[model samples]
Target: MLKKRNFPAVDLIALEREACRRSLATFAQRAWHVLEPATPLRWGWALSAMCDHLQAVSRGEITRLLMNVPPGTMKSLLTGVIFPAWEWGPAGKPEKRFLSTAHMQTLAIRDNLKCRRLIQLEWFQSRWPVQLQDDNNAKLRFENTATGFREAMAFTSMTGARGDRVLLDDPLSAADGNSDAALLAAELAFLETLPTRINNDHSAIIVVMQRLHERDTSGLILSKGLPYTHLCLPMRFEPDRRCETNIGFRDPRIKDGELLFPERFPEAQVAELERTLGSYATAGQLQQRPVPRGGGLFKREWFGTIPALPVGCRFVRGWDLAATEDAEAAATAGVLMAQAPDGRFIVADVARAQLGPMGVERLMRATAEQDRAAHGAVRGSFPQDPGQAGKAQAQHLLRHVLTGFDYHFSPESGDKETRALPLAAQAEAGNVFLLEGPWNAQFLDEIALFPMGKWKDQVDAASRAFTELTTKRQASSSSGTLRGFF
Candidate 1:
């Protein structure tokens, strides 16, 4: 016979290679071993989600794809390295051209090298005939024997090049995300330049990144209602924010606050990450949102609501006034708060209005009268500006409007962020309580948006009230502290 050819063994080998070639996830698992045999693979649902979407792109099902996943999720390893190699070899699409760019050219080159190394492996070569051309095996650009090529470039260097598949991996660094010019440049490259670089109508573009800012490339695309299959996987599952993309793909997890990729990042690891990244970075990089999931500085869960004020509570009605009644102008706000016997802070009532100075004066006088009737012996706290006009305004209000009230005027010492610290600390420690009122929603909403909110009048008043309640008494000096100045 012809040397007794082992056809059964040959057929089994072909089947194994064909399975890897058909599924990106399967190929990745095998490729992971080839690339890093020391560390075992910890498979998760997120990997499956990404592979399914990428496979769709290869099959011409999704033309534009955007994936916003948490950092350290192996997004780069999967999309940048293995997907392209799998496509060229097992998928038998070696003629497909690829243009890959990142925030830095070095990162693009890093993945490009990984992909190049992957295709040349004996295991990969034993199954697929995809071989790199001897003429062009450089770092920035490389070509396969079948005429397909992978070109690595920086987001800033995307000039006169075209590709059938364009991939942008973290186009804006966290530091650069804060710069307007950097954001605009990255966005323009994605929106204006990259679209034109696609070789034909069948070309697909994929963007993978962790969100860094509200105006990041992903945010811009979503805001503009672009035709993209967006897959957002945050570190924790938020039931209300569960994403449903255009391709009828919905987040499968039903429970709120469920961990994503718990196999890789367990509960303890996530807690460590949250502690290490701080609130802001944890929110943006891990939670896939620019703002904290709880709140910026204040968490909504911190303030427990009480049916009524506790006994022996000393009260202060803090005011943050506006100069005009314009609809766009900040609303004049007054917050009445009390320091309880147990040293906790309790917010009682809020009076907010958009009015002129005279109207504000009337409202203030009426509110003071209401405070006197409801709560016994409540003191007033008003903010004084720096210049003579601010002093004059304070004197006018004290003499004419808030006559006979025990009040003091104090100029704000530092920035809004600094002033809000005392209240934020109390809120975080669960020492802040909200007395049941109709204004609870507005107060909590404004507090949650603190420093970042467009209108901070409510927060300013609340911070002042908390400060007034917590300030300690010092011995009187010659400078005469502005305490109860008649």
Candidate 2:
């Protein structure tokens, strides 16, 4: 006699043989007539949403549907394989004009073949022989009762062909999104191709893909705008909901003390995602969060609590210059101010814009001189561009505009973000204060995201100036000099 199966659960250990199963024989692919394990309510809700989305497309209730979910949760299984089978009158009438693409042309062809295989199963051979307009190369066609003929193709070589319903499943493929441009380019080409291949404006485009990275096409789509229901099912979406595909509120798998998390995801694996990715990335790729750009590095919440600079602190300025207002570049300057007795610094400003090198020099001198007037005295700093010409220019500025002022040439190394993170952390944690003035708005906004690994000019200059002063002060005190030179 067969052993009794546990309610709301299955033995995944027995299913371990087919981690990436394609055949319709898997309980997930063929029928949901029985309560299958997965997020059943959510899965059903999503399917219901999908059908509404599809029907909306058929009647123009909506235009495009973008579905992104993490791996091992059957994105294509629901949207591509099973959804299409059900649409084709449930028992394989070979319905829907579905074009499921991966990053590669061949992968698109494979999905095309998978759908054909399901229809060709012995139980549904009436949908077999898949008809031959072009079988070997990835073009498929079938008859639908109301919609007439339907077709599917890989991204490559689909010129003037048309479709009544187009399902672009998993376009910017996760396999190639991270480390391959050619793969991403291929996917974009496919996406562009789908809209063009649509027979009319009445056609609907359904996109299903795994969320890969911040700059991937999925990221681009999510950044800009796309009309679709974005669904994310993490390992712990529900404990009592055994069927991850169900996703219902009353999920039988989710309970107060269920051990679903360990069974679904190892602690080590989840930890890696948390450590390696940013907050936006964690939400988008791992947690399947929508509109991720909304949660940028510097939220508006971090703005209001900015403190005022203390009195009697002299200021020195550091500038990393930019030459032009051309579309690609930004000019930058950093302001480093310090109090006397304690020798502690409070970074007061950042000025970034598009300006010429000479214009930047002039602006730096003016800003420094003006700041000094208020603080008794201050100095101006430069990157010591490592040339006789640059050194002479620095000496010339000290003599002319900055008479009776000090100037120092400093050089920078390593990454800007790396250097600035320690300083930025201090600022964010309320350890650093800014000189309260009109410039605060521009300064705070520019410094917020401060660029990644490259030497962000303004941030670099500020960090380098701090390093130089701190190093000199420590050296002087050790050598028993007059002051801890700030």
Candidate 3:
């Protein structure tokens, strides 16, 4: 049935995974929704996955998990209602422990109420072999005719409670998430608090929340490199729920209201997504993208086009000199970006080090070698300082080294600000790449603060190199025309 749905390759994989959860004696129920009427309108492989993993937990095959869905995808509904009932049902331990967590106490309590409500339903009571305690006990307890109890808890209420599978739901509030500091601190609290409190025997965890921002708990959880599943279903509008290389959406265990996400909101909500969050949020929240910072110019994105160079791609050493001790000199090397017609601006080299001229030169040679090995020997580009003395000094150094590389020395006329403005525009227009790395990042930030031509020596060198290579080729093309002048 799943194969007939015409889902994307990734969605199909999610559906298959969700379906596989049934073999462990527990069922996620989303894939089986068509078989049950009250199953609700949740069928999409990712949504179904929440059901699937919870089912696996019931069977003890899985442990910790993370679900980073977009907002309004009925994440709470599945966690609170459907799975808990399934837990106490065929696959349930009854005596086993469970905990539902959220950023606030009210949310946990609300989920607790849902669990209680579902268990008390007439249909629910018929199938449940175990008898749940009366409401008088409070704190949302369900018993399997034994002393077993599952409870609700807040992030703040961790002092006295312990559980086998602790669920740290969206432990970050929507408001506080705007502040990276608060979110980072809360994320820290999760790892530190749980180990101190949880029991040694029974183990696991689940994180359920929307992907709100980069600095949120989602980021924190990913950084730890723990083994977990991410389930997401963006409900705001037409959502790209299919998993890409770096992002994820809902797990494919359930279907959610016949593609109602797109039908419910669609274009209008997308506009809001654009207005409120820009492309970063749109790519992450709606499109499920790997966070595009500022298009193709930011250096990080351009590294993908690296290639092997030919025998003579023209070795050119573009020197953006910087003195490690002098603050102003240090800021000079803003970009060590390299590019080709087909290749993106890969991180060809970085000239950042607290070094003397020789040290800087060494760094330059090492980077040039790397580029040569990775790419190939290419002609070098050097900025001709407007002053004749500086230009002569550079020429003499190149001539003395016996370096096989050609030094295209050209005089550049412009303030740093004016020179970089074009690069910035070109960057914004997708004409450059930082090839995103630590050194490249520092280089750009410093360049952004450069005072016109004052801090532009490095930029001058780099631009001159690229321009020299390109223009020389152009001039070479018109050599016949010059001869015609005779």
Candidate 4:
């Protein structure tokens, strides 16, 4: 026998109002009815996540935040429409100024109108003390009597205005992804312009968009290693890619390949999206990865992995050298590959890092020593650049750094794509295999993207190593002895 406990009508009303004021999610639910009376509320965890992170920003906990979500997840409605209004009314921050932008002016203005419409509703006005200015009628700009204003503009048109919060929603359209110049300009804008538009060090910048390319704004920020709290939620759950943020936020899904928001977008709908969007679009827009699944030119299924090295295999390590530890710069990569007895290629190990000239030499020498200790008679293949400086550098490594090692230096001929063709053919034919190690993911990702990927140091080293290994295999067949060079 259980009895139901009930509060007074007045008390219940007060409690509901207090809850709406305290939490952004509650406020968004209350505001959604006023904005979309015909549409039902299909609430999910993804919506709650955006609200939580946005509230954290409103509380001055996070200054820079980047969110990568799918296309139809109501990202704009939460960030562009509801966030500023809730902060002004419920959160008691009526004086907060906001600047919001999208790829086009029309898109920004559309969200601006929605926010203004929600704020002017009778129910909203009765509860919150927000008063709009009489002259605040422009689609691009609006103001409240409490000194809070929201301005809308294109991402390229961001200048001559500052705000307490900057919201960038879908800053680049996928239609323009084919133009490399356009992509570069968008990245440059984020790096050079957007930072200048913030009011102060305390101001917050929030970017919400689906990844469109490897060189998009999100990619640039991540590659440059800038300080931003990233919250990436793909359409499906990938256990290996479950993102954990600095704010103690992690994807709660435990199952692999589970739907992110099945309430709104069911499994069937997601399948249709994948089929229609194709692999490239689906990967960028839905999966939050710029590369296609199973890879681009180098298919993931084409290569296999082995647990241990095969017996009677000849080993060689290739070096693609670079100086300076810049995040945007190319890294020095070394690939240790083996030619098995049955004429198959095994990628035993890969080591890559951005370093100075001295650091590069140290790593080369260290890698040589390690390879020799593990696999006997592992030879080194170093690339020789054109001209006298290149010859001097190669001679220096052979004489000073690698004094006792068997090595050879040869000038690299042809472009990177052409040189990688032979390896790509072997990989396509299922002849290329990888030795099981911790380096598989990065190595495969780089190889998958191939010539189109941003960094090619690892692929270049692997290609050179494969060439060196095969060349020796052919030479030994004719000469009947393994030749050595120091």
Candidate 5:
């Protein structure tokens, strides 16, 4: 009962040729398939754009390409592993030489092994028969029969290497990036030594790394205003900001806070990363903007200290919550401040701890009870962040934990810099006082660092307290409704 089943004839030769003509992205996908077949490759838009940019550089269409992507986004795999293999095999450019370096020799060698393993795959060798030359096969360097070679070196050993194409992957580690001397040495190596390693004027240079510091390789290269095709892919999309590749592929995410690769890392996971990295570090590594440490608007010496809390001063506790028990997550901060009759502000106490959601609620309740016992009637100020989720969180805290407490939920407006400016100005004028407390050192350090510090909960909570205290006291004084709290 079969109605003569007919299938199209398979064109094995034609299909093989077509496979050779596959784009770099497809080549990477297939290579991943061959290398790790069980684990399917998740091709996000960012990776596709990155592959296209790399392909342009390989084709001599672009001389310099600077790519910035968050860690664990397959940046090293795509750029250092798959691209080189694709260039030699399907692209038919086995004669091209590559010099790859990393901040550490182990990282460079790791990629070297991946590339060699990829080329040695039966699928890859059957498609493009580029045999490795005898006696030249090693972990750090290798050569093929076509005279093309790949040399993996540490960043410190780039003085004597030469190549037609140079790839620098994460030239500085997190610790090195934070050090002035280390960053200076890296900058010098990139500017003075790295360029000399190019074999010819037509040689291409590629740098792939997340932003680490203001003077890091990416920052230095960008500051020079050189002709570089920059491809920046942040973990989350920032509204009104877009990165365009030279081949005309633009970042596809149009919404703010949209994830770069939700299939691999969901929104919750990225948020956890942000919390663990803190705002300042995340701004650089994840958001591609390294804020300067000393360039913050607030200054350390501006903070003045008082001997003790003034009697009859109105008190309020401002809270900034993280709601995670993880030690790496941002800590929840509760700053207690008092407004004097003479319009001066004094920080009475600061309590900060990392806790889960339930733990945070308990801490808030206990802090409220303690403050009430000490200062009769203390008001609590909580920031109602933007969006419906923020509003719902505020409502939940009010209903579940803050019942019977005098509190005000103010909708936060403007950026952190803007909101902290008023307090910064007051502190700079020597009007704000820090009452002697155990939390003095930590609080001052965070406040002085302001927008640049890793943990900013203290700064946020203090700013909220200052704003609330000043505004409420001003309103009461103007309306002639000023009342005293025992």
Candidate 6:
């Protein structure tokens, strides 16, 4: 038997690399390794799913894909830079042309250059022998020997360009996204201009961005109910909610508050981000909701503070119960209000917490105790949402949670916004006084955003409290007059 000459270690390594370069996922890992060898790869399920989606797009299985991920999550590197190169190499679509755009020209060019640098690496060129064509070897625009080309342009300057693949990387910048007009322009360009630039019917369009506004490009595209595969990767993994991808990779996080990529952005870093961005800004940029800043409804300065509750003031505690105990679930909110002698409402305290059904019952009982201690003869109001389920929930709470408390359960009359108008007007007119407490800032923040804020439990609870108090007072006044006449 001819003894097989033992292959050298270098030869075996080269053979393994060549095998890996055949698949898009393996090729992307190799590319990242070769280009960024010093940096450790903090690979996560989101990144893996993103790579699989890109491969699907390359194989013509998916025509359009929308990837919404938080900033600094390597979205740009994977989609805008490496995916195109992988297509030209492992996917064997060397003639594929790419048109990439960003909100700013400089960002687009920077990614284009990084792709160029990645292609120029000795290991890359050695594994996949793609050489840049000298004739069109500019930074913003470049071509390869196989007639493939990539052009980077600003979103505003995407006119008169054609490509087989269109990659939009953060087409709305943080500053530009804040402006309604800019967001509209971006949406229009995406809907009207960009689609016309596709080279053929089979061309692919990939959008990778953080949601900036409810009317941003991602929002506009999704609102149309188009058949586009979406991959949403919020920084914090929401256990109760799983993102479904086209490749059948559902989010695997089974616990609430789990970091998407713990190795890179740990819980501490995410908490710091929340503190820095506040609830409104963080909702959109980090949480992928993009609530407008200083949401146009309620202003902070409109609220005034009171030192103490007046004697013999009528009190009501309104409760809004959420359905689940998941951390991402809406909070169970209780707004405690006291109607003063002047007939203006004073928000004495606000309590908001996430709880399950059993937990909610316990919370309601505890709050009822606190209300009885603070203000004797307190009344309670709980919303009956709609349908049999709502009726059943209201009955359950009445029988179990508020058995001995003086409480009323009524079906919600109108939408949250319509009911909240009275309370909002009171605050705006300086008729509402918030008692000084630690919950004051949180209450103001939630009310200031109103329906736009991520959590509207407090606002809903306050509305119920105010409405129930005024209605009961009117009934009491009318009943007393009839008794006097008798």
Clash count, predicted structure 3: 43
Clashing pairs in 6: 284-290
Clashes of 6: 1
Q: By TM-score, who's the top model here?
A: 4
Candidate 4 clashes: the total is 0
* lDDT against the true structure, each candidate: 0.86, 0.51, 0.53, 0.87, 0.82, 0.80
* Superposition error at 234 for model 5 (Å): 1.1
- Can you write out model 2's per-residue Cα lDDT over 145-173, one digit (the tens) per residue? 44434445555456555665566665554
Ranked candidates, highest lDDT first: 4, 1, 5, 6, 3, 2
Q: Over all chains combined, what TM-score does candidate 1 have?
A: 0.67
Which candidate order results from sorting by TM-score in descending order?
Answer: 4, 1, 6, 5, 2, 3
Task: Summarize candidate 4's per-residue lDDT along 21-126 as a digit string, tens digits.
Answer: 8899999998888899999999999999999999999989999999999999999999999999999988888899999998898999999999988888987887
- Clash count of each predicted structure: 0, 29, 43, 0, 0, 1
Q: Report clash pairs, candidate 5.
A: none
Model 5 misplaced stretches (Cα beyond 4 Å): 1-17, 292-486
- Across 1-486, the per-residue lDDT of candidate 3 in tens digits comes to 446556698676555444433432223343234224664553454455556566665656666667766666556766655566566654445665667677787888787776666656654454455676664347644544555556777774566657666767777765664554566567667768765555554577777776555556666667567666654444332323443322233333244323335533466775676689665455455543324433311333322323342232333445566547555234334234455556333334555445666665566556655655665545555444556686665555455442544334444466544544555555555655444445555455444423211234555555555444344433441221111111
Residue 276 local lDDT, model 1 = 92
Query: Candidate 2 lDDT (Cα, whole model)?
Result: 0.51
List, residue by residue over 15-133, the lDDT tens digit for candidate 1.
87889878999889878988888998999989988998999999999999999999888899899998999889878899999999999999999999999988898878888868788
In model 6, state the lDDT of residue 261: 77
- Best of the candidates, lDDT: 4
lDDT of 6 at 44: 67
lDDT of 5 by residue, 1-486 (tens): 869765554465446546655688877776787777798787787888888888898878988999999888889999889888888998889998999999998999999999999999888887788899889999989999999999899986686669988999999998875576788789888988898999998899999999887678998888788788999888878865588766787898988878999878888988999899876678778888775233356766777888977777999898888888887458999999898888888989998999988888899889998999989889887776677787677777777777778765767677666788888888889888899988998887777655644567988898888887777443332222222221
lDDT of 6: 0.80
